[model samples]
Target chain A: MFSYCSDPETLSGLTWLSCYLTTGKHTSLYLSFGTVLLLLAITAPIALVFGFGGASAARSRFVPLSWLGKAYIGIVRGVPDIAFFLFFVIALDQAFEYLRHTIKCPDWDQPIRQGNDFVVCAAAKLPLGDAPQWVHETYGFFLAVLTFSIIFGAFAANVLYGAMQAVPRAQVETAEAYGMTHRQAFWRIMVPQMWVYALPGLSNLWMVLIKATPLLFLLGVEDIVYWARELGGTKTPKFTDYPHGDWRMWYFGALLVFYLLFTKVSEVVLGRIMRRLTHGQATMGGEAQRKAAA
Target chain B: MSCWDTVADYALRSVGIGERLLPRSDFTLCQQVTLIGSGMIWNIYFGTIALLSGFFLATALAMAKAAHSPLLRKPAEWFIFVFRGSPLFIQFFFAYFLFLSLKNVFPVFSPLTSAWAGALVVLFFNTSAYSAEIFYGAMQSIPKGDIEAADAYGMSGWPRFRRIIWPTMLRLAWPAYTNEAIFLFHATALVFFSGFPATQQMGDALYYANYFADKTFNPFIPYPILACYFILLTLTVIKLFGIVNQRLNRHLPQLQRGRIRLRPMLVR
Candidate 1:
């Protein structure tokens, strides 16, 4: 990382610290913050889409579709979400392989689940047995994004469902009176109006999503938690130039502070957005604003 | 072995009571159910202790936050903010390492490094912060008329708080507090998976579920069983809270009393 980094034992104090911080592992640790951000970036919109579908389906005229939507929204209510995280990673992987196994190895004789092992044909394996390291990493990231989207989508669905209902019957009726179809009213009238109501819940979900990023380590992604543990463990002088005792507490403390600051900034920004959205609206917030101005 | 015998041998396995070793080879439905149910003991233990103890701290903190004096309020406000702001997983890891270091200086702190004491402390703080916020909101929303009425009757300080303020706050906060209890219980699953090592293979439901998933390579069964146990636990929390809620709101007419609606705030 630096020209001074070539010399090992002679370095001490800040010089040694500077070189150590610039190491490849530490660089990866720094980049892992981007991994967390990337995850949030990709998952948020997808979760919203999933939530929209679920909310709409729940409100559908068809009984079975409504039941399906309600179940999707209600599932996370009872079960711990970490269980879902663990289950879906394996379950989705297996489902993919099983589907591929039937198509790719049509004539293969042995059962897929032989006792305990799920033995898929090599051709059916996700990312392929011979794929590059990056491919495997990307595949895992993709699955994680899907899982987070699914769980958070349920929460968002609950919020959106409520928000949709809170959009006032008269507003939708006015759209119908103007000769708009039900679907048109839903899109043109209801959806636009629901955001103000949904903002609070959606902001909360965002914070939860931010906090849940550490669970990425459990999902087998080499995220910040993994790096913190790896780099912060006892490092003897024999191992490297920058030797230190167990510093995991400091590392985790830094992670904690990082999350705190991120959430604080998000709260401030979201508060501004909420204020902007509430202005000129008919809700309690707008009413208060009106009273204040007068 | 019959299901009854399996239950006898493994029913209390999670607490390190009956079984010395878990079933390895032929994983029967009976073994999964019994062992997993055994593990629920830990979940219930962590959840109950944390919720009960957290309630008192939360109540005190809520009052402190609502107090006009900065001397009483600032520390309480910061404590709640720090605990509420960070992820509980990071909190567990940070606390474990902190306890480990503290144990080296004070041997009495050794117990705090274990999951039973250490993880429990983290959960205690975490739930306290959340529940305190709920309580504070409820305190703020307490009708001014009620306090004024108490003042008119010459009620001041302690008597007014005990008879007029506290009960109403509890009634107002009950539904949200119930949600917090369920969230705290679900959070108990993260104990073993975090920094605290599960001693002697004894762990909560998710630990055994993870074991089965690892061995069987079939997640379809064990995870759902774990979820079912949690669902039952959730329902039990709701029911108990509902009873208390009914009692608190008993003074109100049936039409005016607020029903406990379960809005699952999925994560803390």
Candidate 2:
């Protein structure tokens, strides 16, 4: 922040606005955008990995493994995902703390749940009771990422499973005829080819995933929605240099435009990717490309 | 309290009709089930009413998007884009605040500030946009031959659409619209979580489930109970839609009747 920020009351118009925007809280608000992007960056790959595993397990010859995968994939279909989010954040936290409590405080003779409170040993607390603020924040964020990955993983599994099935049987058979093992054929033929089929679903999931980031506020993260509400409320000039009356609509309006632009960009990029993936392939898209070229 | 007594007291609790204070300690399974089931009334109210009203708006919007006039098409396109592109969570916040702002401007908008009116309006618009896009896609894919056949018979405009195009569009769009309905039901759980205060503890299933979770310090029970209720609600929606779908395609041959497949796609 500028030295001019020291006497913000004297400044008016753009000068006051500039200083206000540079405040520590606003900086945090700006950084939270990075947090949203980081979450998307981290969760997408992790969810894809989870999806791949789930899809494979669903297709496994082992009945129990297949059942596990089927249940994992089907669970999200039944429950509202926000319910899963709220449930998992608390449930996973308690589960972790409970595990740590059993391990770390084996001799402590106290019921963990005592009349509406989950009382864990101090040491068993996630990020510990003495841990720094950032540690707790990071721990909460990590849990959120995990929850997002788990829920979105099921959706991605649905997409990938369908994509894997869409791969022609003959392609895998040809890989087998070339003396490749089942695993090798799967890796070479099925996995590589499924992307083209999965792109549409995956892109849609990406858009949904983007939209769901605002729910991070519900998960108790200091994300954009939290900041928008906090900073956009009526603040008197007595308390602050630059006071504003209920500007939450403007803040949320900005967020709306941001999301709209993001989705538009994503659509363009996904379209290009789809075209690239389809080129010189056996699908109708590729055939059309070939026809156009001829 | 006895289970029967508890049920009698809290059966309609979510709508402010029954018990004033929820059960504190000694939370029984019966209490959880009965209370959560009571809360489900709001979910059913929001979902069915929103979907029923949104269906008509969505049909009109879909036709507008598919219309030849740019004026109609552009607004329709933007309406879908604005609603579809943003998170419903934020939409709820934005709408609640907007309604509050309007209440200051005019006393007539005061009732719209409440969750029952405000949140329902958001859900209505949200579902309308989603369902419109689905219908628009279906409209685009309506077989050219059918339209050509209608043209050959001199059927045009409203008559052509009413007799031929609309039914086929509905048939084609039914499966996707079913998915949208399910998502809308799920999205209704978000109403209370947003800016809307669940006045007098009259909240939806998630709200009660959240209350139980907060009270018990154990999320394992209440969330699943809510999920079970929702799963049943989802199945019921599918069943009801399936009947309507059957009716929509009654004139078609059995083989050609589009089978309703439940694909749980994106949530708002």
For candidate 1, the docking band is: high
Evaluated on CA atoms against the true complex, candidate 1 attains a DockQ of 0.84
| RMSD (Å) of each candidate, 1 decimal | 1.0, 1.4
lDDT of 1: 0.94
Show what share of the native A-B interface contacts model 2 retains.
0.73
Clashing residue pairs in candidate 1 (N, C-alpha, C atoms within 3 angstroms): none
Residues B1-268, candidate 2, lDDT per residue (tens digit)? 6899999999999888877998888899899999999989988899889999999999999999998999999999999999998889989999888988888889899988888889999999999999999999999999999999999999998899999999999999998898899989999999999999988888899998999998998998999999999999999989999999999989989898899888878688
Compose the digit string of candidate 1's lDDT tens values, residues A125-240.
Answer: 99899999999999999999999999999999999999999999999999999999989999999999899999999999999999999999999999999999999999998887
At residue A219, what lDDT does model 2 achieve? 90
What's model 1's lDDT at A266? 96
Off by over 4 Å in 1: none
Per-residue lDDT over A186-255 for candidate 2, one digit per residue giving the tens place of the 0 to 100 score: 8888998898899889999999999999999989999999999999999997987678899888888888
Residue A117, candidate 2: C-alpha displacement in angstroms: 2.9
Error of 1 at A265 (Å): 0.5
